[model samples]
Target: MKNFVFSEAVVMAGLRWTIVLIFMLFGLAKFAEYEAAGVAKIAAHYPLFAWMYPLWGESGASNVIGTIELLTGAMIAVGAFSARASFVGGLMGIFTFCVTLSFALGAPAFWEAGYGAPFLGSTGQFLVKDAVLLAACFAIMVDGLRRHTAP
Candidate 1:
Protein backbone atom coordinates (compact mmCIF):
# COMPACT_ATOMS: atom_id res chain seq x y z
CA MET A 1 0.00 0.00 0.00
CA LYS A 2 2.76 2.41 0.94
CA ASN A 3 4.68 1.62 -2.23
CA PHE A 4 1.58 2.18 -4.31
CA VAL A 5 1.01 5.55 -2.69
CA PHE A 6 4.60 6.57 -3.30
CA SER A 7 4.41 5.52 -6.91
CA GLU A 8 1.24 7.52 -7.43
CA ALA A 9 2.81 10.59 -5.89
CA VAL A 10 5.85 10.23 -8.11
CA VAL A 11 3.67 9.96 -11.18
CA MET A 12 1.76 13.07 -10.21
CA ALA A 13 4.96 14.99 -9.71
CA GLY A 14 6.27 13.87 -13.06
CA LEU A 15 3.09 14.93 -14.78
CA ARG A 16 3.28 18.37 -13.18
CA TRP A 17 6.88 18.85 -14.26
CA THR A 18 6.16 17.62 -17.74
CA ILE A 19 3.45 20.22 -18.13
CA VAL A 20 5.77 22.89 -16.78
CA LEU A 21 8.56 21.91 -19.15
CA ILE A 22 6.23 21.99 -22.13
CA PHE A 23 5.14 25.50 -21.32
CA MET A 24 8.66 26.65 -20.58
CA LEU A 25 10.10 25.39 -23.83
CA PHE A 26 7.16 26.74 -25.79
CA GLY A 27 7.50 30.20 -24.26
CA LEU A 28 11.26 30.31 -24.61
CA ALA A 29 11.20 29.34 -28.26
CA LYS A 30 8.56 31.95 -29.04
CA PHE A 31 10.33 34.66 -27.10
CA ALA A 32 13.64 33.99 -28.75
CA GLU A 33 12.03 33.49 -32.17
CA TYR A 34 14.20 30.37 -32.08
CA GLU A 35 12.89 29.05 -35.40
CA ALA A 36 11.10 32.13 -36.63
CA ALA A 37 12.61 31.96 -40.07
CA GLY A 38 11.64 28.36 -40.52
CA VAL A 39 8.16 29.02 -39.19
CA ALA A 40 7.77 32.00 -41.46
CA LYS A 41 8.98 29.93 -44.34
CA ILE A 42 6.24 27.43 -43.58
CA ALA A 43 3.63 30.13 -43.06
CA ALA A 44 4.51 31.73 -46.35
CA HIS A 45 3.48 28.52 -48.01
CA TYR A 46 -0.02 28.77 -46.56
CA PRO A 47 -2.66 30.78 -48.37
CA LEU A 48 -4.78 31.43 -45.29
CA PHE A 49 -2.06 33.23 -43.39
CA ALA A 50 -0.73 35.00 -46.44
CA TRP A 51 -2.80 38.00 -45.47
CA MET A 52 -1.82 37.74 -41.80
CA TYR A 53 1.78 38.43 -42.66
CA PRO A 54 0.86 41.63 -44.40
CA LEU A 55 -1.56 42.62 -41.65
CA TRP A 56 0.58 41.98 -38.55
CA GLY A 57 3.99 41.20 -40.03
CA GLU A 58 6.07 38.28 -38.83
CA SER A 59 7.84 40.18 -36.03
CA GLY A 60 4.61 41.55 -34.61
CA ALA A 61 2.90 38.18 -34.63
CA SER A 62 5.91 36.58 -33.02
CA ASN A 63 5.94 39.19 -30.26
CA VAL A 64 2.25 38.74 -29.53
CA ILE A 65 2.42 34.99 -29.51
CA GLY A 66 5.58 35.13 -27.39
CA THR A 67 3.90 37.31 -24.76
CA ILE A 68 0.96 34.92 -24.41
CA GLU A 69 3.28 31.93 -24.23
CA LEU A 70 5.40 33.53 -21.51
CA LEU A 71 2.41 34.47 -19.41
CA THR A 72 0.82 31.03 -19.70
CA GLY A 73 4.11 29.33 -18.86
CA ALA A 74 4.71 31.56 -15.84
CA MET A 75 1.19 30.96 -14.56
CA ILE A 76 1.61 27.19 -14.69
CA ALA A 77 5.13 27.28 -13.23
CA VAL A 78 4.13 29.39 -10.27
CA GLY A 79 1.43 26.89 -9.37
CA ALA A 80 0.23 29.11 -6.52
CA PHE A 81 -3.20 29.19 -8.11
CA SER A 82 -3.07 25.78 -9.64
CA ALA A 83 -6.75 25.42 -10.44
CA ARG A 84 -6.95 28.75 -12.22
CA ALA A 85 -3.76 28.16 -14.11
CA SER A 86 -4.87 24.72 -15.18
CA PHE A 87 -8.19 26.01 -16.37
CA VAL A 88 -6.57 28.77 -18.38
CA GLY A 89 -4.00 26.48 -19.87
CA GLY A 90 -6.59 23.94 -20.86
CA LEU A 91 -8.71 26.58 -22.52
CA MET A 92 -5.73 27.99 -24.35
CA GLY A 93 -4.75 24.59 -25.57
CA ILE A 94 -8.24 23.97 -26.88
CA PHE A 95 -8.26 27.26 -28.68
CA THR A 96 -4.86 26.60 -30.23
CA PHE A 97 -5.89 23.15 -31.33
CA CYS A 98 -8.99 24.48 -33.00
CA VAL A 99 -7.09 27.21 -34.81
CA THR A 100 -4.47 24.82 -36.07
CA LEU A 101 -7.11 22.40 -37.22
CA SER A 102 -8.81 25.13 -39.15
CA PHE A 103 -5.60 26.08 -40.85
CA ALA A 104 -4.85 22.48 -41.69
CA LEU A 105 -8.29 21.86 -43.16
CA GLY A 106 -8.76 25.18 -44.90
CA ALA A 107 -5.47 25.36 -46.73
CA PRO A 108 -5.56 22.33 -49.01
CA ALA A 109 -4.85 24.39 -52.07
CA PHE A 110 -1.71 25.70 -50.46
CA TRP A 111 -0.69 22.15 -49.62
CA GLU A 112 -1.40 20.99 -53.16
CA ALA A 113 1.06 23.60 -54.34
CA GLY A 114 3.66 21.85 -52.13
CA TYR A 115 4.56 25.11 -50.45
CA GLY A 116 2.28 24.37 -47.52
CA ALA A 117 3.16 20.69 -47.06
CA PRO A 118 5.73 21.53 -44.41
CA PHE A 119 3.09 23.39 -42.39
CA LEU A 120 1.08 20.19 -42.25
CA GLY A 121 4.04 18.57 -40.54
CA SER A 122 4.41 21.44 -38.07
CA THR A 123 0.68 21.58 -37.40
CA GLY A 124 0.54 17.86 -36.80
CA GLN A 125 3.28 18.21 -34.23
CA PHE A 126 1.46 21.09 -32.55
CA LEU A 127 -1.79 19.16 -32.39
CA VAL A 128 -0.19 16.16 -30.75
CA LYS A 129 1.76 18.20 -28.20
CA ASP A 130 -1.15 20.48 -27.37
CA ALA A 131 -3.54 17.57 -26.92
CA VAL A 132 -1.26 16.01 -24.35
CA LEU A 133 -0.79 19.32 -22.59
CA LEU A 134 -4.54 19.84 -22.55
CA ALA A 135 -5.05 16.49 -20.92
CA ALA A 136 -2.44 17.33 -18.30
CA CYS A 137 -4.06 20.65 -17.52
CA PHE A 138 -7.49 19.06 -17.21
CA ALA A 139 -6.12 16.41 -14.87
CA ILE A 140 -4.44 19.04 -12.74
CA MET A 141 -7.63 21.03 -12.50
CA VAL A 142 -9.70 18.02 -11.53
CA ASP A 143 -7.15 16.88 -8.97
CA GLY A 144 -6.81 20.29 -7.41
CA LEU A 145 -10.56 20.75 -7.17
CA ARG A 146 -11.04 17.35 -5.62
CA ARG A 147 -8.35 18.02 -3.03
CA HIS A 148 -9.79 21.39 -2.11
CA THR A 149 -13.26 19.99 -1.54
CA ALA A 150 -12.29 16.76 0.10
CA PRO A 151 -13.76 16.08 3.53
Candidate 2:
Protein backbone atom coordinates (compact mmCIF):
# COMPACT_ATOMS: atom_id res chain seq x y z
CA MET A 1 0.00 0.00 0.00
CA LYS A 2 2.73 2.41 0.91
CA ASN A 3 4.63 1.71 -2.33
CA PHE A 4 1.47 2.22 -4.35
CA VAL A 5 0.82 5.52 -2.64
CA PHE A 6 4.39 6.60 -3.30
CA SER A 7 4.01 5.68 -6.95
CA GLU A 8 0.95 7.84 -7.20
CA ALA A 9 2.93 10.71 -5.76
CA VAL A 10 5.60 10.24 -8.40
CA VAL A 11 3.02 10.26 -11.16
CA MET A 12 1.42 13.43 -9.82
CA ALA A 13 4.80 15.09 -9.78
CA GLY A 14 5.25 14.30 -13.44
CA LEU A 15 1.82 15.76 -14.13
CA ARG A 16 2.73 18.88 -12.22
CA TRP A 17 5.88 19.35 -14.25
CA THR A 18 3.93 18.92 -17.48
CA ILE A 19 1.58 21.72 -16.50
CA VAL A 20 4.51 23.87 -15.42
CA LEU A 21 6.25 23.52 -18.77
CA ILE A 22 2.99 24.35 -20.53
CA PHE A 23 2.66 27.50 -18.51
CA MET A 24 6.26 28.47 -19.12
CA LEU A 25 6.18 27.99 -22.88
CA PHE A 26 2.79 29.59 -23.39
CA GLY A 27 3.66 32.38 -21.00
CA LEU A 28 6.76 33.17 -23.02
CA ALA A 29 4.78 33.09 -26.24
CA LYS A 30 2.34 35.69 -24.93
CA PHE A 31 5.08 38.30 -25.28
CA ALA A 32 5.12 38.04 -29.06
CA GLU A 33 3.08 40.39 -31.24
CA TYR A 34 1.23 37.61 -32.99
CA GLU A 35 0.28 35.81 -29.83
CA ALA A 36 -0.80 39.02 -28.19
CA ALA A 37 -2.93 39.91 -31.17
CA GLY A 38 -4.60 36.54 -31.19
CA VAL A 39 -5.47 36.59 -27.52
CA ALA A 40 -6.76 40.13 -27.90
CA LYS A 41 -9.27 38.94 -30.45
CA ILE A 42 -10.56 36.30 -28.07
CA ALA A 43 -10.60 38.56 -25.03
CA ALA A 44 -12.46 41.21 -26.96
CA HIS A 45 -15.38 38.83 -27.20
CA TYR A 46 -15.44 37.87 -23.53
CA PRO A 47 -17.56 40.33 -21.59
CA LEU A 48 -15.75 39.83 -18.32
CA PHE A 49 -12.42 40.35 -20.06
CA ALA A 50 -13.48 42.86 -22.68
CA TRP A 51 -12.91 45.76 -20.32
CA MET A 52 -9.20 45.00 -20.31
CA TYR A 53 -8.91 46.13 -23.92
CA PRO A 54 -9.88 49.67 -23.06
CA LEU A 55 -7.71 49.71 -19.96
CA TRP A 56 -4.52 48.07 -21.23
CA GLY A 57 -4.79 47.54 -24.99
CA GLU A 58 -3.61 44.34 -26.70
CA SER A 59 0.05 44.14 -25.68
CA GLY A 60 -0.53 45.26 -22.12
CA ALA A 61 -3.30 42.75 -21.54
CA SER A 62 -1.25 39.93 -22.98
CA ASN A 63 1.77 40.92 -20.89
CA VAL A 64 -0.36 40.88 -17.78
CA ILE A 65 -1.67 37.42 -18.60
CA GLY A 66 1.84 36.22 -19.40
CA THR A 67 3.10 37.50 -16.08
CA ILE A 68 0.35 35.64 -14.27
CA GLU A 69 1.18 32.41 -16.09
CA LEU A 70 4.90 32.77 -15.37
CA LEU A 71 4.26 33.46 -11.71
CA THR A 72 1.83 30.56 -11.41
CA GLY A 73 4.31 28.24 -13.12
CA ALA A 74 7.10 29.32 -10.79
CA MET A 75 4.93 28.63 -7.78
CA ILE A 76 3.98 25.17 -9.05
CA ALA A 77 7.62 24.32 -9.80
CA VAL A 78 8.54 25.30 -6.25
CA GLY A 79 5.60 23.14 -5.17
CA ALA A 80 7.73 20.11 -5.90
CA PHE A 81 9.08 20.71 -2.40
CA SER A 82 6.37 22.75 -0.73
CA ALA A 83 2.76 21.72 -0.34
CA ARG A 84 1.56 25.21 0.47
CA ALA A 85 3.12 26.57 -2.71
CA SER A 86 1.43 23.85 -4.71
CA PHE A 87 -1.92 24.76 -3.25
CA VAL A 88 -1.49 28.34 -4.36
CA GLY A 89 -0.37 27.22 -7.78
CA GLY A 90 -3.39 24.98 -8.04
CA LEU A 91 -5.67 27.91 -7.30
CA MET A 92 -3.99 29.97 -9.98
CA GLY A 93 -4.33 27.15 -12.46
CA ILE A 94 -8.02 26.88 -11.73
CA PHE A 95 -8.54 30.56 -12.42
CA THR A 96 -6.45 30.45 -15.58
CA PHE A 97 -8.31 27.54 -17.16
CA CYS A 98 -11.67 28.93 -16.13
CA VAL A 99 -11.06 32.04 -18.18
CA THR A 100 -9.73 30.20 -21.20
CA LEU A 101 -12.54 27.69 -21.23
CA SER A 102 -15.05 30.51 -21.24
CA PHE A 103 -13.61 31.55 -24.58
CA ALA A 104 -15.18 28.53 -26.23
CA LEU A 105 -18.72 29.80 -25.79
CA GLY A 106 -18.33 32.91 -27.92
CA ALA A 107 -15.67 31.71 -30.34
CA PRO A 108 -17.06 31.87 -33.86
CA ALA A 109 -17.79 28.49 -35.45
CA PHE A 110 -16.45 26.61 -32.48
CA TRP A 111 -18.75 23.77 -33.40
CA GLU A 112 -18.34 21.71 -36.54
CA ALA A 113 -21.93 21.81 -37.72
CA GLY A 114 -21.22 19.43 -40.55
CA TYR A 115 -20.94 16.61 -38.05
CA GLY A 116 -23.36 17.72 -35.28
CA ALA A 117 -23.94 20.16 -32.42
CA PRO A 118 -21.57 18.29 -30.13
CA PHE A 119 -18.84 17.98 -32.69
CA LEU A 120 -16.07 20.55 -32.45
CA GLY A 121 -14.23 22.57 -35.05
CA SER A 122 -10.56 23.47 -35.04
CA THR A 123 -10.87 26.18 -32.41
CA GLY A 124 -13.09 24.00 -30.27
CA GLN A 125 -10.59 21.19 -30.50
CA PHE A 126 -7.91 23.45 -29.09
CA LEU A 127 -10.12 24.82 -26.33
CA VAL A 128 -11.47 21.42 -25.28
CA LYS A 129 -8.04 20.37 -24.04
CA ASP A 130 -8.39 22.83 -21.22
CA ALA A 131 -10.99 20.56 -19.64
CA VAL A 132 -8.28 18.02 -19.01
CA LEU A 133 -5.91 20.67 -17.80
CA LEU A 134 -8.61 21.93 -15.46
CA ALA A 135 -9.07 18.45 -14.06
CA ALA A 136 -5.34 18.11 -13.55
CA CYS A 137 -5.33 21.38 -11.70
CA PHE A 138 -8.08 20.05 -9.44
CA ALA A 139 -6.04 16.95 -8.74
CA ILE A 140 -3.03 19.10 -7.91
CA MET A 141 -5.17 21.15 -5.60
CA VAL A 142 -6.42 18.07 -3.77
CA ASP A 143 -3.00 16.47 -3.57
CA GLY A 144 -1.42 19.62 -2.26
CA LEU A 145 -4.10 19.99 0.37
CA ARG A 146 -3.70 16.36 1.42
CA ARG A 147 0.06 16.62 1.69
CA HIS A 148 -0.11 19.85 3.62
CA THR A 149 -2.52 18.36 6.15
CA ALA A 150 -0.89 15.00 6.54
CA PRO A 151 1.24 14.21 9.56
Candidate 3:
Protein backbone atom coordinates (compact mmCIF):
# COMPACT_ATOMS: atom_id res chain seq x y z
CA MET A 1 0.00 0.00 0.00
CA LYS A 2 2.91 2.34 0.65
CA ASN A 3 3.75 2.29 -3.05
CA PHE A 4 0.15 3.10 -4.09
CA VAL A 5 0.17 6.94 -4.52
CA PHE A 6 -3.11 7.54 -2.72
CA SER A 7 -2.71 11.32 -2.80
CA GLU A 8 -2.73 11.53 -6.59
CA ALA A 9 -5.67 9.17 -6.72
CA VAL A 10 -7.57 11.34 -4.24
CA VAL A 11 -6.95 14.52 -6.21
CA MET A 12 -7.96 12.95 -9.51
CA ALA A 13 -11.08 11.48 -7.97
CA GLY A 14 -11.94 14.81 -6.36
CA LEU A 15 -11.62 16.65 -9.67
CA ARG A 16 -13.85 14.14 -11.44
CA TRP A 17 -16.49 14.39 -8.74
CA THR A 18 -16.29 18.16 -8.79
CA ILE A 19 -17.05 18.15 -12.49
CA VAL A 20 -19.94 15.81 -11.88
CA LEU A 21 -21.33 17.97 -9.07
CA ILE A 22 -21.21 21.14 -11.14
CA PHE A 23 -23.28 19.62 -13.93
CA MET A 24 -25.74 17.96 -11.59
CA LEU A 25 -26.46 21.07 -9.58
CA PHE A 26 -26.78 23.33 -12.59
CA GLY A 27 -28.84 20.73 -14.40
CA LEU A 28 -31.27 20.54 -11.53
CA ALA A 29 -31.40 24.28 -11.28
CA LYS A 30 -32.37 24.54 -14.95
CA PHE A 31 -35.87 23.59 -13.97
CA ALA A 32 -36.32 26.62 -11.79
CA GLU A 33 -37.92 29.76 -13.24
CA TYR A 34 -35.03 32.01 -12.29
CA GLU A 35 -32.43 29.74 -13.79
CA ALA A 36 -34.41 28.93 -16.93
CA ALA A 37 -35.20 32.60 -17.54
CA GLY A 38 -31.60 33.59 -17.16
CA VAL A 39 -30.49 30.92 -19.61
CA ALA A 40 -33.14 32.10 -22.05
CA LYS A 41 -31.86 35.65 -21.98
CA ILE A 42 -28.35 34.65 -22.96
CA ALA A 43 -29.43 31.94 -25.38
CA ALA A 44 -31.50 34.53 -27.19
CA HIS A 45 -28.32 36.29 -28.17
CA TYR A 46 -26.70 33.06 -29.31
CA PRO A 47 -27.47 32.58 -32.98
CA LEU A 48 -27.00 28.83 -32.82
CA PHE A 49 -29.91 28.52 -30.43
CA ALA A 50 -32.27 30.77 -32.39
CA TRP A 51 -34.30 27.83 -33.62
CA MET A 52 -34.99 26.68 -30.08
CA TYR A 53 -37.77 29.13 -29.26
CA PRO A 54 -39.87 28.37 -32.31
CA LEU A 55 -39.62 24.62 -31.81
CA TRP A 56 -39.88 23.94 -28.08
CA GLY A 57 -39.96 27.31 -26.35
CA GLU A 58 -37.54 28.42 -23.64
CA SER A 59 -38.70 26.24 -20.76
CA GLY A 60 -38.87 23.13 -22.87
CA ALA A 61 -35.44 23.74 -24.27
CA SER A 62 -34.03 24.34 -20.82
CA ASN A 63 -35.55 21.11 -19.50
CA VAL A 64 -34.03 19.19 -22.37
CA ILE A 65 -30.64 20.72 -21.66
CA GLY A 66 -31.13 19.98 -17.99
CA THR A 67 -31.73 16.33 -18.76
CA ILE A 68 -28.56 16.22 -20.80
CA GLU A 69 -26.53 17.82 -18.02
CA LEU A 70 -28.00 15.54 -15.35
CA LEU A 71 -27.20 12.50 -17.44
CA THR A 72 -23.70 13.76 -18.12
CA GLY A 73 -23.06 14.23 -14.41
CA ALA A 74 -24.41 10.82 -13.54
CA MET A 75 -22.28 9.22 -16.22
CA ILE A 76 -19.15 11.07 -15.08
CA ALA A 77 -19.68 9.67 -11.63
CA VAL A 78 -19.63 6.12 -13.02
CA GLY A 79 -15.84 5.73 -13.07
CA ALA A 80 -14.63 3.06 -15.55
CA PHE A 81 -18.03 2.69 -17.17
CA SER A 82 -17.93 6.37 -18.07
CA ALA A 83 -15.47 6.40 -20.96
CA ARG A 84 -17.80 7.43 -23.79
CA ALA A 85 -20.03 9.33 -21.42
CA SER A 86 -17.26 11.56 -20.20
CA PHE A 87 -16.06 12.23 -23.71
CA VAL A 88 -19.52 13.21 -24.85
CA GLY A 89 -20.09 15.21 -21.71
CA GLY A 90 -16.86 17.05 -22.26
CA LEU A 91 -17.87 17.84 -25.81
CA MET A 92 -21.24 19.02 -24.56
CA GLY A 93 -19.57 21.24 -21.99
CA ILE A 94 -17.30 22.66 -24.66
CA PHE A 95 -20.26 23.36 -26.92
CA THR A 96 -22.24 24.98 -24.12
CA PHE A 97 -19.39 27.26 -23.15
CA CYS A 98 -18.49 28.10 -26.71
CA VAL A 99 -21.97 29.46 -27.08
CA THR A 100 -21.72 31.16 -23.71
CA LEU A 101 -18.43 32.79 -24.63
CA SER A 102 -19.87 34.08 -27.87
CA PHE A 103 -21.90 36.49 -25.83
CA ALA A 104 -18.80 38.67 -25.86
CA LEU A 105 -19.23 38.94 -29.61
CA GLY A 106 -23.03 38.93 -29.89
CA ALA A 107 -23.93 41.23 -27.03
CA PRO A 108 -22.76 44.79 -27.51
CA ALA A 109 -23.97 45.67 -24.04
CA PHE A 110 -21.10 43.67 -22.62
CA TRP A 111 -18.69 46.17 -24.16
CA GLU A 112 -20.85 49.29 -23.88
CA ALA A 113 -20.28 49.43 -20.14
CA GLY A 114 -16.66 50.43 -20.67
CA TYR A 115 -15.50 47.23 -18.93
CA GLY A 116 -13.37 46.52 -22.02
CA ALA A 117 -12.27 43.06 -23.16
CA PRO A 118 -12.35 41.36 -19.77
CA PHE A 119 -16.14 41.89 -19.32
CA LEU A 120 -16.42 43.54 -15.92
CA GLY A 121 -20.09 42.87 -15.16
CA SER A 122 -21.28 39.89 -13.14
CA THR A 123 -22.97 38.22 -16.09
CA GLY A 124 -20.03 38.92 -18.36
CA GLN A 125 -17.53 37.61 -15.83
CA PHE A 126 -19.71 34.57 -15.21
CA LEU A 127 -19.40 33.42 -18.82
CA VAL A 128 -15.69 34.17 -18.83
CA LYS A 129 -15.05 31.63 -16.06
CA ASP A 130 -16.46 28.84 -18.21
CA ALA A 131 -13.16 28.80 -20.10
CA VAL A 132 -11.48 27.16 -17.12
CA LEU A 133 -14.21 24.53 -16.90
CA LEU A 134 -13.96 23.96 -20.65
CA ALA A 135 -10.23 23.19 -20.34
CA ALA A 136 -10.82 20.89 -17.39
CA CYS A 137 -13.46 19.01 -19.34
CA PHE A 138 -10.99 18.52 -22.16
CA ALA A 139 -8.49 17.10 -19.69
CA ILE A 140 -11.16 14.75 -18.37
CA MET A 141 -11.91 13.63 -21.92
CA VAL A 142 -8.25 12.98 -22.69
CA ASP A 143 -7.81 10.96 -19.52
CA GLY A 144 -10.93 8.94 -20.24
CA LEU A 145 -9.79 8.23 -23.80
CA ARG A 146 -6.36 7.18 -22.60
CA ARG A 147 -7.88 4.81 -20.08
CA HIS A 148 -10.27 3.38 -22.64
CA THR A 149 -7.58 2.78 -25.29
CA ALA A 150 -4.81 1.61 -22.98
CA PRO A 151 -3.46 -1.89 -23.41
> In candidate 2, what residue range of length 10 has the lowest lDDT sum?
1-10
Residue 9 C-alpha lDDT in model 3: 49
Off by over 4 Å in 2: 1-6
* Candidate 2's TM-score: 0.91
User: Per-candidate TM vs. native?
Assistant: 0.63, 0.91, 0.82
Which runs of model 3 end up more than 4 angstroms from their true locations?
1-7, 108-112
> Largest TM-score belongs to which candidate?
2
The C-alpha RMSD of each candidate to the native structure, in angstroms, is: 5.1, 2.6, 3.1
Q: Higher-TM-score candidate among 2 and 3?
A: 2
Clashing pairs in 3: none
- Candidate ranking under lDDT, highest first, comes to 2, 3, 1
Q: What lDDT score belongs to each candidate, Candidate 1 first?
A: 0.58, 0.87, 0.73
- Per-residue CA lDDT of model 1 for 1-151, tens digit only, reads 5665556446666776777677667656754555555456556556755666777777655556566666765655544356556556545644544554555554434343455555444445544455566667666656555545668
